[model samples]
Target: MGTIKRDKGLDNTLKVMKQGYLYITNQRKRLGSENIFETRALGGKKIIVISGKDAAELFYDNDKIERSGTLPKRVVNTLFGKGAIHTTTGKKHIDRKALFMSLMTEGNLKHLRELTRNHWYMNTQKMEQMDQINIYRESIVQLTKIGTKWAGVQAPEEKIEEIATDMDVMIDSFKGLGGKFKGYKASVDARKRVEDWLEDQIIQTRKGKIFPPEGTALYEFAHWEDYKGNPMDSRLCAIDLMNTFRPLIAINRFVSFGLLAMHEHPITREKIKSDDDYAYMFSQEVRRFYPFVPFLPAKAKTDIQFEGHPIEKDTMIALDIYGTMHREDVFENPDDFYPERFKDWDGSPFDLIPQGGGDYYTNHRCAGEWMTIIIMEETMKYFAERVTYDVPEQDLTVDLNSIPGYVKSGFIIENLREVV
Candidate 1:
């Protein structure tokens, strides 16, 4: 059995995700703790491989399968705070989700689209200066800024960028299980800076009274009271904005993963560029190939059996997203990068899912699914037409169990005009 080692380098992690199961099954002969193998920890809980689509469907029914294991407690405290959204139960979660959905109306969508386009044009030029930049980091900053602005928080780019970086660092601190303590410490400092920044913005907005006379997303939300009818706390509102950024960050990470797949599999890239509808199909393939959250956990609400394994009530169910997507039994040539698999089809077969969903706007299923697709389609088109760069001689191997290496170099956009 391989000992689970902490801090395996990027290269090694990629290797583990891609083939760790093969090593465990055929070579190792038994599932090891070091390997991400499905095993029963507590008595009679069925832990098995699952894909994004199934996970989405299952998590959508979250009430039936209550999330058993805890997400990083530090993350909950730092990013979401003890709000109606983050830690709430029963009616509270439902109501908070509704509040979040209210902000996603067509009016806000238009504003966000305009902001995203402007940011892309403004940032593309900046990218030309560096040999290579982390697209994931870049997208996160832009998206975070956009969300903050929607929340009526306005500040200098430098200041906002600094805050964004701190937020990201706080998020990264919680990468592996049991690292919640590390995140807890970082979140203290990070949370304070963010809260102070948000508090000032709320004060300024209220004082200026420049909000739309009738109502804006921010205005309506700022005025939103809980079930008891008390005014929502301004401090919690800012932290909610921070939580909004988390999913966006995760979305962009998967988007970058899609970009990497396109670069490496130019055939799929060409298919996507040929037609607009292909954009959605291409996204499905990308979702199947590269989702950020690999293992999503849900607790059993009652005793159940999946594939003959008895799962007791209240046990954590580890759904293996990567394994489900890559399973050959469900997908023909599952390893191949093919977009046609999702074209106008039911999309149930391939189990493609970029965003997790058991219910709309719940679990890891992003509320910004449409928003993410729009960005991905537009950005992929830009890169496909405008850029051409050789990947340097290096190991670009990927692992299903580990995070992928973000592209560091080997891309050049020769035709900026093609971005449109």
Candidate 2:
């Protein structure tokens, strides 16, 4: 029955923008509290910021909070798309989620891994003939090809660069104010272009003009039905298909970080090469250590009490994903990059929520999480065992203020060659 601690700010929007991933963690420390606090941002909207495993569990409890009407329109438009699975709740959410989870089966994951390996091999061969290669830029193209093909969408070879650029702009614009309008425009244009393409594919599939492999994402989603058994709207189906395509490309951020990790922690290079188990652990640590998603937003579904503080209905709640992963109580020496920590890890969903926490089938966790890990693991192995590149002197510093901060120089490298 204690009063919830509060920050003395009229609105924290600017502060949050300035502090970035450190915003919530810094607030908890400044207030001398471990978990819950209240602040205002987003035009005086009250936000309840919560961190740690217990808080994450409560934040994701569908009975307590829901995602519908929670995210800003800008986010919905630019990042998730209108009518996306991210905007649904209850039974509708479950149904839409199943459509996504269906694509993550062991067989499909193996297929994706094989596709990733082949694309990486081909890209490296091309890079071997170049003066320098940017891992981030190259990853976007390679993954766009892999993701679209694996998802059963066929982007013409001539259009891959244009499609990849649009996807990149949409992702980059969601986080900062500097280019938000541009991001929104890019999102609108990209959606129109991609949806038009996907709708045509769906029409072709229906008319038997194009044959997407059975069980592939495009085929399943294009033909998916709603909870009530009606077919999904064409635009929504397109959104869901991009959901698969975009996240796979977004793994480029992690690929950049993975290379940075290999550069900084040279021992990991050998460990990842020699042992598959170590590679898995290393991938987990990279996700836990690096900052990708800052927080997840939901709204209080009803009046609720958390840790004795009353939360009014419609209050915005942000589960601090970054802070939770860096909590000292949950992770010993939370700041260090240590892959060995996961060797005996108990695999708690809430504690390691880089994507999200809870059952993948029923909750708001990212559906493509397994695929992200696989891509990273495969990329890590390739960097460690297959490539011999020199990390030239460049700015490797990461800006915490950026929503998806990247290595400043994009982790420049030279003398690229296969480790024969």
Which regions of candidate 1 fall more than 4 Å away from where they truly are? 1-59, 78-86, 179-184, 203-217, 347-350, 361-364, 386-395, 399-420
For 1-420, candidate 2 gives per-residue lDDT tens digits of 888898778878888888888989999999987899998888777889989999988977888888888877887777778889888888988988988998888999999999988888777778888787888898899989999989999899999998888788778766753223545666778767877888778778767888899889988987777778898777777787889888788888888898998888899998987887988999999899998989888888999988888999988998999999999899999999999999999998889999999889888899998998898888888878888998888889888876777888877777889877
For all the candidates, what are their Cα RMSDs to the real structure? 6.3, 1.4
Clashes of each: 12, 0
The residue-by-residue lDDT of candidate 1 on 59-120, one tens digit each, is 44655567523454554555545452645556666666677777677877676667655666
The per-model lDDT (C-alpha) reads: 0.56, 0.86
Runs in model 2 with CA error above 4 Å?
A: 176-182
State the number of backbone clashes in model 1: 12
Worst 10 residues of 2 by lDDT: 176-185
Which numbered prediction scores highest in TM-score against the true structure? 2
lDDT of residue 229 for candidate 1: 80
